[model samples]
Target: MPLSERKVVARRVTLELANLVIKYGRPIVVNLGVGIPAMVGEVVAEEEVEDLITITVESGTWGGRPLYGPDFGVSLGAFAVISVPDQFTMYEGGVIDAASLGFLQIDAQGNVNSFYAKDRIPGPGGFPAIASGAPEIYYAGLFTAGKGAKYEIGNGRLKIVSDGEIVKFVKKVDKVGCSSKVMLEQGKRVLYITERAVFRLTPEGPELLEVAPGVDLEKDVLAKMEFSPIMRREPEQMDERIFGHRRMNIKKELLKAIRA
Candidate 1:
């Protein structure tokens, strides 16, 4: 894919994560942490969702607006910026809800491995800090099945699907970003979403919340997953509106922004 197209995918994926956050808003302020979560901060600022839901980034961008074009705010100001320490304080204080994090791997218990990858590809960032700060943590990534998404079905059973190149959405993570054992002990809420399905951790194991539309064959979803989830009726549609929000309102400046 072209670099330009890749950037568009990144923006769209980030917006999907943010849109989920906006749809599931709480009555209180929700502090969005770094990376993809920060892009959510941009989405909220743009009012593509709702202003009642506040956004704060650990990188000191709070309630910021988006800068148009492929630059991703490279040549423009970061709107509604805040201080680094303040963001951390809010997070560490448990002020954040539903942190949608990107990870190299995520296990059934919701432990994430983002700090490092196989042979140590990606270095650790603030994963531990954010996990500590946020009670309700969600891990997300694109779906794939190769040699990576493997588990012996020791606990129960694993009906394998297409093997993934990277072992994300695995039965057991090679490293510990967070721990399922710890989450079980703490009774914390854990969620996992890929392009294919959504799973949540329970005492029994991972429960299938929903599956991605069109890929509804049990083996197709199961074959790709490391652990077996209780069968669900069907997954939900991501919605066409998610792709086209420009028609929501048409301001002259909005049109000029797109053109310019």
Candidate 2:
């Protein structure tokens, strides 16, 4: 397949994520969210992450590599698989350690709105349960949409860090997919990972932990985010080691297997 600029960039984002999850050392059940992160599981699985982390598909299968082609396949290097029927059950109830999911919008309350795209809203399928109930959640998406990169963080609820800026990170969520108030109380970790920067929702609100390597704070990442997070020391590049050899880049593998 010929590579386009968009595809190349998207793959970079996926690779970065492959690095992020591995840092945690394959948790018991890494909920492979749709899109890039699913491929990340395959990448990790081909390597040793599978031995450490049991990769579960939204499907029920527990220990088989991905079979890609038939289900609108994408290739990945993973070990073990399951049917989607079983996967959603675990998803709806709660048996996930970390979820690398995407979102269309995120507000100060830490709520997410990924289902509401223009033509249709898929309604929140398994989102509320996963976002709210998951022990660890990582919200992943692109940094800037065509929205021109600016907005206002209204002064309704939480006493926050900043207001009026670009979007996705906010002073309060417009609707509650996940609540910062609840997260802090429960002590579960919620991360905001984007192509532009990485932030964490803490008791203090969104804190800027790291920017992708070679990206600058004021010049690149910070200015793009709607609000300024409390930047800790310069953020480091998520380690590539996370996507060890065998399992790394499993997308193609799964897709190929399913096709075969």
Candidate 3:
């Protein structure tokens, strides 16, 4: 069966993150948050780099594929399953090398609202602890929200059939789930990854880093955002392979990059 467009976008974001892990060229522990961030475990597992990239979930599981939905708090083949408090202890103590978290909204200042909205109240769930502790954080999710968004993917490209009505990047988030100020003071590396664009949180503010292929810079990206991002240079195109259906063979790429 073919993967849905949403799932494909999730995989693409996950693979991009996997590439970042590979670039470290050494063993590291990484925490996966809920939603699209949970897909990282599946991507790492498929890449066969579990030994190098240790997967951790807030539910106290480590070194396995992180489950989603009803099974969100467990891993399929975890090497360890400690108490939830112990897992949080590691996070609050800065034991993890990195973390990937989902966001409900992101502001011009890079503040993230992962939980809470005008209509919902999921509350902040391990986001505060993990975001505060991890030296590096990647915020992952779709480019837009709300109902009726549509897209097409083929031939290594993405075509926006109809965009979501809700704009995720805003002037100010409804609530600040993760503070950009604190992260900057702590000197953490931060990135926002969406289906069509990537932004890096810098001293100057959010900088536009990369854009997916076939997406219009003006109509599809810049025009949709609430505020302008720093364009230090022409943004690079996101890797073309992510748009296709075939396996990325990320293990081979990781090994090659490590060897070089």
Best by lDDT: 3
Which is superior by lDDT, 2 or 3?
3
* Alpha-carbon TM-score of each model against the true structure: 0.65, 0.64, 0.93
Q: What lDDT tens digits, residue by residue, belong to model 2 across residues 1-260?
A: 12221222233334443444445433356555555444444444444345444555555555444433254223244444556656676776677666666676776445566666556655766566666556777776656554344322111111122322435555554445565687778777778776445678866667776554434557656665555566566676543322122223434433343344
C-alpha positional error of residue 67 in candidate 3 after TM-score superposition, expressed in Å: 1.1
> Where is model 3 more than 4 Å wrong at Cα?
1-5, 12-23, 256-260
Candidate 1, residues 19-69: lDDT per residue as tens digits? 444445422245443334334444444434333444554465544353333
Clashing pairs in 3: none
| Angstrom error at residue 4, model 2 | 10
| lDDT computed for candidate 2 | 0.52
lDDT of 1 at 220: 54
Q: What is the lDDT for 83 in model 2?
A: 61
**Model 1 local distance difference test score:** 0.51
* Candidate closest to the true structure, highest TM-score: 3
Q: Write the per-residue lDDT of candidate 3 for residues 182-234, one digit (tens) a residue.
A: 89999999989888888999877789998989999999999999999989999
- Please give the clash total of every predicted structure, in order: 13, 41, 0
TM-score, cand. 2 vs. native: 0.64
